[model samples]
Structures are given as structure tokens and as C-alpha cells.
Target: MRQLKIAVVMLLIGGLLTTAAFFLAFYTAEVQRFGTVTLSEEIDSAYPLVGVSNEGLQYERPWFSQKIFYFHVPVAEASFLVLILSAFFGVRFLTTRRKEYDTKSRIAMETALTFVALTMITGVLWTKASWGVWWDWEPRLTTYFIMMLLMVAYFVLRNSIEDEERRAVYAAAFAVIAAIDAPISFFITRLIPSQHPVVFKSGFATSNLLPFILAQVGMLMIGYAIYVMRMSEERMRERLEVAKEALED
Candidate 1:
């Protein structure tokens, strides 16, 4: 119960920080120009472009589309972190053959799935804004999609089997296998040519950096809070099941 209260407090703090980051991203962060569009003659445009001089007109891009970055990157990073956590517990379960480890692995995978879905949704929005496409078969995008499917398959694999111990072993093995793709998905952008921006290679300006860092930290806190809360709920459910069985006996 004390842990649950701490989780709630963390969740509230995370929500506040994430909200602050969102506002800072839109209001405080400097607007970045996408690229300079040079034109020989002046033309009517809807976009907020600067430099209307007759000598080679240059247009400045708006910050409308790029605002998604603040939310998208953090969610994507959180997803990968949770996926690795699930894999870690899965390995532990395999080594010890413990029910608690299996429960932890399953819950972590569930949280990973939620974040993965958010990442994909935001990725699609970012792609459409930047590339004018809702979906693309780009290396990073494709690899992440495959990872999501593998996560979905993990639950399916668990539910299909009748034997409890066998299901845990098989699911644990599958989770470890699924986790192999997470690193591939993350590093694929660095390893190959992709439309996605590499944050590590390309540094962020101070204005953007603060909000990004805040969002990242807040998101991780929220993820941990969620994991803790879910684990508590699972334990409570297990206890109820045990009490019911005892009453029946």
C-alpha cells in the first residue's frame, strides 16, 4: 500500500513535468527553420516565411510540425527501455523457474506494448508531417513494427498453452527473442540511411534540450509508476484468487 501511494505520487509528478515540457516546447523553445526555399520571383504562400526581398526570396519554415518531436522521442525511448526490462525478467524467470518473475515479465511486456503503440502513432504523425506519408517501409519504421508484432505474439503464445509452467517457459523464451529486435530497431537509423533524425549524432540546441530532457525524465518516471502500480494490482488479484481457493477448500 505504501508503494502504491508512492507510485501515485510519482505519476502525478510525471504528469506535471510532462505537461510543463509540452508547454515549453510550444512556447519557450525556439522555432526551427526546416530549410531555406529560394525563389526567383515572389509567390503567394500560406506558410509563415521570412525574407520577402526581391533578391532571391528565402522562406523560413514554421514550428507546427516539429512540435511532435518533444512527445514522440521520449515515448519511443520509454518503449525500448520497458521492452528490455521485460526481457530481463523473462531471463530471470527462465533461470529460477519462479512465478513472480513470470508475472513481472508479463506486466512489463504489457507496459512495453502500450508505449510501443504510442510511439508508432506519433511516428506516423511525424512521418506524415515531415515526409508527406502516413506510413513508410523505412528500415527503422519496419523494424519497430516487427518488434510490436513480436510483443503481441508474446501474449498470444502465453494464452494458447494450457500448462502453466510450459507457458511461462515458452513465453519467456519468446520475450528474449523479441527483445533482440529492440536494439536493431533503435540502432537501425544510425546503421543505415533513414528519414528519422538521430538525436545523438545531431545535437540539440539549449532551448530544445531542456524540454527534451524534461520530457524524457518525466516519461521514464511515468513508466516506472505504471509498472509498479500494475505489479501491485497483479499481486492483489493473485491474493484474491488464493483466498477464494482457500474458502472453497
Candidate 2:
């Protein structure tokens, strides 16, 4: 009962924060000028690099799209954090053979999958608007793509196994490897050069900071709420199973 009450309070807080973040992002944050390009009929003329031109060829992004960054970055960060949690619980389950750890791992992974999907969708849109491409093999993007694939593989492995214990063991092993692989992918992606221009440099303006921070805190709270709710459901199911087993005996 206490846990349930705590979960309910968290859900309410998370909902409020999320709503506040949404309004902040939409209403605040300075409009960022991405870059400039010439629209002249000189088809082969070299264009001046961004931030170097004195001409008025540059244009600022739509306020709505710029605001998307606040939400997108937070969700992306939360997804990675949740993936790490999934791997941690996976390791715990393998070492202790505890059903509770498995339950936690599974729920964390599910939450991660949900966030990852959102990250991918928002990332693609950001890419399109910023890079003029629907997709690019950029470092951050590529690492996330691989992360998403590893998540799918984790579920595939779980579905293939028949025995509960064996499934838990196999999934745990894969989770560890996947967790390790995610950082490696990130490193390799950053190491490689790409045409995509990096935005959101260090030392963001005060206008941008508020929305970004609010979005991040809100997303994290929501992620925690989702995890707790799922965990409660799993616990209830486990309790029901125990009750059924005792009755059968």
C-alpha cells in the first residue's frame, strides 16, 4: 500500500513537471540561427560558411522545431539511462538467480524500448530539419541506431528461450554485452568525421537552459514513474502466481 501511494504521488509529480516543461519549451527559449545559404541562380558558386557571412542569406529555424530540441534531447538521454538500468538488473539477476531482478530487468528494458523509439522518431525529424537529410550515419545517430537494434535482439533472445531460468540467464548475458556495446558504438561514431553540423554547443544561453533543464528533469521523473508502475504490475502478477501454485498443491 505504501509503495502504491508512493507510485501515485510520483506519477502526479511527473505529470505536472512534464506539462510545465512542455509549456516552457513552447513559450521560452531563444530562436537559434542555424546557417545561411544563397538562393541565387549561380548554381555552382561556392557558399560562405555559417557564422562567417555578413550577408542576409541565413534564416532562423521555426520556433516549434527549435523547441522540439528540449524534449528530444531529454528523452534521448533518459533512454540511454534506462538501458543502463536494464543491464544493471540483468547482471543482478544472473548473479543472484532472483526472480525479482528478472522482473526489474524486463520492465526496465520495456521502458527503454519505449523511450528509444521516441528518440529515434524525434532524432530523424531533427536530422531532416538541421541537416536536410532524413537520416545520416553521424556518430550520435548511428550509435542510437545500433542501440535500438541491440534492444530488439534482447527481446528476440527472450522469445526464443522456453525455460524460464535459461531465458533469464541468456538475457542477462546479452544485456551485459549490449550495454558494453552501446558506449563503444558512441565512441566509434564520434571518432569518425561526418558532414552533419553539430548544434547545441557548450554554455547554452540562459533562455535555452531553462527549457532544456526542465525537460530533462520532467522526462526523468516520467521514466521513473513508468518503471515503478510496471514493477508494481509485475509484483502483483508474481503474487498471483504464488497463490495459484499453493492452491494447486
Candidate 3:
């Protein structure tokens, strides 16, 4: 009951912060020119030329498509963070063989799945806006796709097992292994050539950074609220099951 109240409070606060961030990103934040193009070939006469460089190259200011970053980045980061949390609980479950830890791990995985799905939705839109494509098999995208598959597989593995303890063990082990891909996906752009922008490497202007931070913090709070609410529901269901079994006996 207390947890439910706290979850409601967090949901309200998180919703307000996320809404404020969205408005600020669209209005108050300065539109950033993410990439500048230097024309090597014969430049089109209709191109919006910013200026000419010292080497006599035409510099064209590209269209602003970075607005999606405010949402996309925070969701992506939250997904990985939740995945790690799931894995942490998974590890604890393995060491202690406790049902509560397994429950927490499962709930965290569910939250991660939610964040991952949102990341994919926003990522697809960002990809279309930036790369002019709906999908691409780049390193980051491919690895994240695989992570989502692994998350799905975790639940499948859980449901397939009839023994509760065995099911928990297998799911916990799988989650730990799946978490190994998170860092790989995160650093893929730095390790190899990729079209994805490295937001942290270049840094951000004050106007851009504010909304980004708000979105990130708000998203995490919402994610936690979701986890808490789900856990509460699960506990109620467990109690009902116990009562039903007692009455039947």
C-alpha cells in the first residue's frame, strides 16, 4: 500500500518533468546543426550555403534533426541501466537461491523490456530522419536488436520450465549473460565506423544539455515507478494464489 502511493507520486512527478522537457526541447532549446557538409563535387546552386572555407570548399549547413536526441538518448540509456539492474538481481538470486531476488530480477527485466521497446520506436524515427531509412543493420542497432531478442528469450525460457526453481536459475543465468552485450552495444560506435552520433564524445551546449538531463532523470523515475507498481501487483497475485491454495486444501 505504501509502495503504491509512492509509485503514484513518482509517476505524477515523472510525467510532469518529462512533459516539461518535451516542451523545452521543442521551444526553448536552440536547434543544433548536428553535422556540416563540405561539398567535394560541384555544389548545387540551390544549396543553402553557410560560407566558403579557406580551401575554397563550399560548407553547407545541414538540416536540424537532433531534436529526437532528447528522447531517444534518455530511453536508450534507461534500457541499459534497467538491464544492468536486472542482472544485478539475477546474480543475487543465483548466490542466495531466494524467490524474492528472482521476483525482483524478473520485474526489472520486464521494465527493461519496456524501455527497450520505446528505444526502438524512437530510434526508428531518428534513423528515418537522419539516415533517410527506416532500418539499418549497423553495429549499435544490430546489437540492441539482439538484446531485445535476448530479453524475449528470457521470458520464453522462464515459461517453458515447469519447475519454478529451475526456471528461475536458468532465467537468472541468461540475464547475466545477456547483460554482457549492453556495454558492447554502447561502445560499438567508438570501436568501429558507424553512422550513429556519439553524443557524449562531442559534449553539448547548455541549452541542449538541460532538457537532456531532465528527460534522462524523468525517464529513470518513471521506469522505477513502473517497476514498483509491477512488483506490488505481483505480490498481491502471489498472496491470492496462496489463499486459494489454502482454501482448496
Best by TM-score: 1
In model 2, how large is the Cα lDDT of residue 51? Answer: 34
Residue pairs in clash, model 1: none
Q: Clashes in model 2: which pairs?
A: none
Candidate achieving higher TM-score, 2 or 3: 3
Residues 168-216 of candidate 2: C-alpha lDDT, one tens digit per residue: 9999888877777656654563467755334453358887788778778
Best by lDDT: 1
lDDT of each: 0.91, 0.78, 0.90
> What's the lDDT for candidate 3?
0.90
For model 2, the run of ten residues with the poorest summed lDDT: 40-49
- Kindly give the stretch of ten consecutive residues in candidate 3 with the minimal lDDT sum: 54-63
Each model's backbone clash number:
0, 0, 0
Between prediction 1 and prediction 3, the one with superior lDDT is 1
Q: Candidate 1 vs candidate 2: which has greater TM-score? A: 1
Residue 142 CA error for candidate 1 (Å)? 0.7
**RMSD of candidate 1 to the true fold?**
3.1
Expressed as tens digits, the lDDT of each residue in 62-118 for candidate 3 is: 456788889899999999999999999999999999999999999999999999999
